[model samples]
Target: MESVFEAFLSFYLNPGFFYGTVLVVLLILFISIFYRLFPNSGFSILFDYFFEKMYDFFEDILGNEEKKWIKTYVVILFFVILISNLLGVFLEILVPVFGNIADTDVSLLKKYIDIPTADINFNIAMALIGLLIIIFEQFRALGFGKALYEYFPIFGKNYLPYTRGNLNPIFDWPLFILVKIFDLIISLFLGLLEIVGHFAKVISLSFRLFGNVTSGGMLLAMLVGAISGLTLTYLNFEFPVLGPVILYFQSLLVALIQALVFPLLIAIFIKVAKFA
Candidate 1:
């Protein structure tokens, strides 16, 4: 367990993780201080407004029954993705200073100061966790037996043989055999398809988040590189002012959208599972 914990920490050695962690900590501290210092301030008012909006957003989609437990999960998922998406923008401001302090080149720091959502491993893990929650919720709503049949409906009673009395070899044998064969084929096909669909959900969820964030990060990096090269080669300015401005606005919008979308989809999945 100790080794496993150490390995996890090693994964965040890059500047992205450093800045992301610091920003999250600082955000919590800021909120705490504001709440304590001025309970009736605009900061609290704005926060309450945002929280109510988010609560209503999920509550509308999940309905009242599920809104109780599932709201917590949705909130957690939204904030984590939101922070990760915003991390790239924060890195834009902090990377140069950190690079200089570490005596590392700017080029090296750029790669390290990436958005966490851009990391496929993080996206995949989050997707898998969402998938697992759906499965677990289904099992809780419907017992294990029913949940098993839900995923592989072929195993349900409807597909099984209805053996009422002793079979007649002459009259029922042929028809019974045909029905059994047909049932087996249909069940196998549907079961395999259902299994494949579950796997596909994981792939789709992970790739959707990963691809969007990664592409945005890459675009920002490319713009920064191009602008820096041109300015250094042709102009007198050392910093690329346009790149940062563009990245800030673009990343901010993308971050909010992706963060909202991910949790929204997860909530939908949970709803589907509950109804299924």
Candidate 2:
């Protein structure tokens, strides 16, 4: 009982967990109120443009009119990642600096400077959701036989991806049987590998997002620290300001591209599974 209590407290007391929960709740509340109260604000205008652009982007990737049903999900996913990425850059900087307020118990926030998407558990959870969606979409779009066919194409078909049967010019009966047996074993091996590769996609997707976001957050944190710690004796003009500005744009591009790429790849996977 004591160990269980300690475990529960450790998890619930974590500053990162607390900050993530509070910030997400606050963000959702602010957006709900902001849109309802001020429909024509500049942020609303910007959001409208972003929505249209993202619609076109997802439509191009997932083109069929039948697939339009998922547009809302895709758009929401893009915004979630993009917003989290943007926050990672700003909050990591802000939380450490302003989080030290003595009057408030929120000073614990300083220790939780890492971004949400930077956490491996968070990325893996999202990736697992994608995995579930992939399975569901494949089954719904392709039906059970065809969807299963994707992984076991060579098993029941008695055919390889390429031409087969008697590569030897001469009619050697035993040699032909040997060749077919070898090819059959190889094809079965490959089909099993295909199934493994499908699950591996989740790991690849998780690691890609985790690595990019975490690296970007860490890089920005270090750059900010180095710039702020610079001495007067080291330099006069602040050319150092340009370093972060340039890196900031680069991180912005990375964040946007990754946000798009993760969903785009999922769409492509579904499309391929359907067609296969």
Candidate 3:
């Protein structure tokens, strides 16, 4: 069965991809409907509890708004990332158009629709979007002038702690001019490094999401293959019987880790950008 499944996966008929996509859409739809129908339930109470907790957490960090809009943003980002990551678990079963292509056959990219998150472009886009939001939050909080000043600390007569009443022009005036010039140069370079760091965030965020999801699915696949190999050779069974159970448990762990990690990272980022 493992060999057969691998052969099927190797072929272009990637039913797993389609199934995963459908499952994601359905999952979101069902969750939406469920929440709408039962606006108040045991489940909803738990949801409200978390919402309040998140609100308070962000409120303490942000101090600007009593409401936890940051948490809400992080929640939505996590949901999208979680669904994309889970798509990998079934993507192999989905047939690809060129999976079995011969040397003479025409090649088309459309034939391969693996987990969308596996592609760097998708992950980078997600990170860029988050970075944009963070930038907006910073600007909104600090205002343009102050935010810009943070990146470029200018020096002048107003640079030091001395008062105008100090009658030490010979020492203070020349020292102030020299210090201000040095500060301006250093601040300018630091500002550029900060801007470059923004792009680095995109790379970090994208790779982290893609790597975690793909590796988790690959691990599950290996586990299934191992179990099937053992059962077929020793027990001569058609199915391992325990494959699904083990896979489900592993999947649950992966799903929860990915979901929690992504959002938690986002929240941390919000704190860094907004507060730090």
Candidate 4:
């Protein structure tokens, strides 16, 4: 009970959790604005025009309409992910402070600064959304019957039950039926595994983003600390002014990469879904 209480308290007090929630809210606001400014029809036209240009760029790499569609999605995904990742950059300043009567606690209440992809829930939610898009594409491509057949293979009578002069015909039919039954059962299990794998992707994606960003920040913090320590050791610790400048540039590059990666991967996911 005590451990559970402590765990709950830690989760509630987590800065990342709160920051992620705030960032999500802000993202929704911007998305709403975009929708309000350009309704589906208008956005579709704009997307189509750009999508065509993108398709042309990938002309050498991918052939046919199917390939072009995937390329189009990838481009759009890059933008969304990139923007969300960098939302933290604007909140580099404005650290929060909390105080209490019992222990005079101080908490960093950041006005801004959130790495959306760092949260597992956020990554999983996006992946699930992408999965839906993929399923929709599959439905559009093959219709219901073909899609079902693709997952569940069934041999027809026309293709079998012949050229059996040397074997028992009755026995062969039962054997074939049993084989198909096993195949169907295996297919069901395979489907379950696929679902689990998708969830695994979400976990990996979230951890990758979180690990990269936090690790980079820690590195920069260490650099700054080391530089300041050396300065203090040699001379009355004036300030590691240059450390901030260098770290800031490094942070900028890292932030940009993370921002781009999120959307790029999403686009790839969309493309893969179409084929599935």
Q: Write candidate 4's Cα lDDT for 56-126 as tens digits.
A: 64443333555555565655555455555455443332221221124532214331234565556666776
User: How displaced is residue 129 in candidate 4, in Å?
Assistant: 1.9
Backbone Cα, N, C clashes tallied per candidate? 0, 0, 13, 4
> Top model by TM-score, which number?
2
TM-score of 2: 0.77
Off by over 4 Å in 2: 1-9, 12-14, 95-110, 153-180, 229-231, 236-242
Model 4 worst lDDT window (10 residues): 92-101
Local accuracy of candidate 1 as per-residue lDDT tens digits, 123-230? 888888988888888888888987787566653334757553466767677777677777777776776776787788889888999888877766776777678788
Q: How well is each residue in 10-84 modelled by candidate 2, as lDDT tens digits?
A: 676655655664675577678768877887999877877888888887787777563566766777777777777
**TM-score of every model versus the real structure:** 0.75, 0.77, 0.67, 0.59
- Which residue pairs overlap in candidate 2's backbone? none
Ranking by lDDT: 1, 2, 3, 4
Query: Cα lDDT of model 4 overall?
Result: 0.58
| Runs off by more than 4 Å, candidate 1 | 1-19, 22-26, 29-33, 93-115, 154-176, 228-243
- Residue 111 deviation, candidate 1, in Å? 6.0
Which parts of model 3 are misplaced by more than 4 Å? 1-26, 38-68, 86-115, 154-181
